[model samples]
Target: MTDPNQSVLSKLPNNVIDEILIRLPFRDAVCTSILSKEWRKHWCRLPQLTLDSDFWKSKKDLTGDKRATSNFTMTIHNIITRHSGPLTKFTLCIQYWEIYPPIDNLLYFLSRNRIQHLVLKLPRQFKLPPSFFTCLHLRHLFLQNCLLLPPPDFKGFDRLIRLELHEVTISSKLLESLISNCLLLEQLVLRISDTLSDIIEINAPMLKSCDFTGDMTTICLKCVPRLTELSLRYYRKDWKEFDVANFLTSNFFESCPDHLEHLHLDYGVIAKGQEIPKKLPFDLLCVKHLCMCIYLDRDEILCPLSLIRSFPFLQYLEIQMEHNFKKNMPALECLEMEAFPDVIFEHLREVTLIEANASIREMQLIKLLLAMSPALVKMVISPHRFLGKSTIVKTLTKLAEFECAPKAEIFLKLV
Candidate 1:
């Protein structure tokens, strides 16, 4: 972003002063207008404006009173109207119902002057004005609690590189259309409502990272070969009918970049004695780091073990456990690897087992890990709570008996 007025502040002909003032809080920057006529002129030419609820809340009384809101709206109107030059970044997170008409007018005004980065967090699902989408130069857009009604002739924001939609009501078709047009898109974050019934399809070839909060099975990925990072906020349940084949055969992981590095999700998609298939639906041979959240039921380690087998080149693995199943379920007397005889962590280096109890089942896993992973370097076992010191000694003694491959160091964290 260039200085708004070259002749106004050309004394030193440097952007040092301009950046300092513009980067300040919007209220503090605006207050400079009261300093002098020259300062007021400088402010009117500000190229970027960011306003939120905190600006008006400074007044102690009647925070949301009608008169207070009126003054706030009028003040904003005056500031924007008086401002000159194109706005490169404009953010408004104020949740005032009275600002709908004012906001529409303001967006229309800014659109003509080339607003590139826009963020709007409304009080409710306010339908965006048509002028909002006409800002074609936008590179980044963040919208929350708004109804997205793209204009009929809407070609997407072609230059948009990043997009975030938090609880915004938008049709699945529009979302796909808008994403497909963003040829330069790299990151996408979505926190959509469950009411959006249609299956969401992602076809962005340039996309690299995605943070999503919804059912893992609902989204289908296509042609996204560059995606290297994926994080899901999933609340899992005892999925009786959810077959492992669904995930193994799903293109969600099949279309991932060859070097996919990070995977985070909470879904116990396997049982204690599930069958292992000959061929998987997806390839994870390039995965270097993997994190999984699983429910520990009846000392079932296969829930996580099955997924780890796919990452042939895995270097870092973290298993986050939850006691979502029967708490009193007895642990197996010893760990057994007869079921996974062909699986090995050849390139595995570090392993972290969080929220672990030193039950026979968990200890067996630790023993198996020590005997396997030849390249293992560090192992961290974080207990959910404190166990007596004797329990630690006994566990270590048991591990000492296991014939291991790598001389990996171990740490016990009582957290």
Candidate 2:
């Protein structure tokens, strides 16, 4: 039999249970209400309500009214009205279809509620409301593929700590003004398309990390005194330059003057016809752990050995490509249909290559590795294939024999 005292404590006050459940993912938390009458009632009073419907597939012939939008809106409203305190997080992610509820009404409801974190994720064409910028209590905001109305001047909250913009295009100047106004901002991730014009200026003093994925858009970051981590993932042929001399430059790198430890850069360039091969820049001094990935298409070429040698303190290096390796051509040769820089890899502790098809070019790369990087402790080469475990093991052994580097511990990923 259940202890009466224990049962009484287990069935805590409704507000306490609701607050606890509010922290959970929306669906899981809502399901808890099904356990008993008490829980069912309390779930409706949860402060944080989240909806991620990417898994919900729409029927080909269903109309908007016949879908789940009406119930979803009703349930959300019921939960919000039942809650007495502010919401900690509110997320709504809808993918795979073109169905949506009223955007204006949703924004108005959220604006009135004291929400600290808000996430909006929709597939390509969903339009967002301008009133979203008026949220004064929001500290974390994430938008994916939702068109944001350009703020007239940057009058959002000073309490914002993290802002992630994905698949949306806004003027760099307006974005810069917004960044400048977020004094307490920390992480800024930009996954944008090409409506970007002019340079983005970021002036958050307490910013600690920054991650950007897109074409090289001009950016200016200022007053980042304690900044440390940075990740740049480039998928196109746009130039992203960092002027070390400018104060805004410090926002991304913080100059690492007091020992900035981690630095990661994954970039790819697709060269166009008649376009001049550009020298890739790797100009930094104090990075302890560095990961640089460069992808060169048939028309794009890699930088010179002199340029690769510029990084004096790199402890790790990873170079990946999608080509036949037997040709023994330089990775950069494909980009420019030309030769590669002189080989130089001395200080690297760990080196890795990914998805190279041709075995001959793989052998040449290993030969260069043996001659250049005497200090390399580990080397891994992996092919791009999906097969059984036995087949993968056999392939690994074959590739290892083809470009064997005895000096370093080699791991061949044949699968």
Estimated TM-score per prediction? 0.78, 0.74
lDDT of 1 by residue, 1-415 (tens): 5455644554533256568678887888878766544566666677778777656565421245566566656976887678887678888875554434346777887778788888987756788888888789889999988888987899999999999998888888888888889989999998864545677788888888888875566677776788888877643333444445456556667667785688876654454455544445555887788887756554445546666766788899888867642444565543466666787888999999898766666676787777668888988888766556787777777766766665688877765
lDDT of 2 at 43: 59
Error of 1 at 348 (Å): 1.4
Report lDDT (CA) for all predictions: 0.72, 0.61
- Evaluate residue 358 in candidate 1 and report its C-alpha lDDT on the 0 to 100 scale: 66
Q: Runs in model 1 with CA error above 4 Å?
A: 1-14, 34-46, 56-68, 95-102, 235-245, 268-282, 297-301, 323-329, 332-335, 352-368, 380-407, 411-415
**Candidate 2 error regions (>4 Å):** 1-25, 45-47, 54-68, 95-100, 108-113, 123-125, 150-154, 221-225, 235-267, 272-283, 296-301, 304-307, 324-346, 356-358, 387-407, 413-415
Best by lDDT: 1
List the lowest-lDDT window of 10 residues for candidate 1: 234-243
- Predicted candidate 2 versus true structure: per-residue lDDT over 1-415, tens digit per residue: 8667556746797777866776776667767766665566665555677776532334531233434666656755766566555556778776444576655556666778867899987757677767676677889999887765645664867899999988875667667877788889888888865646676666778888877776534555456666667767654434533221232123444334344455666544432442332322434565656655543334333332233454566667666665533334444332221243454455677877776544444445555554566677887767556334674566566556643235578777665
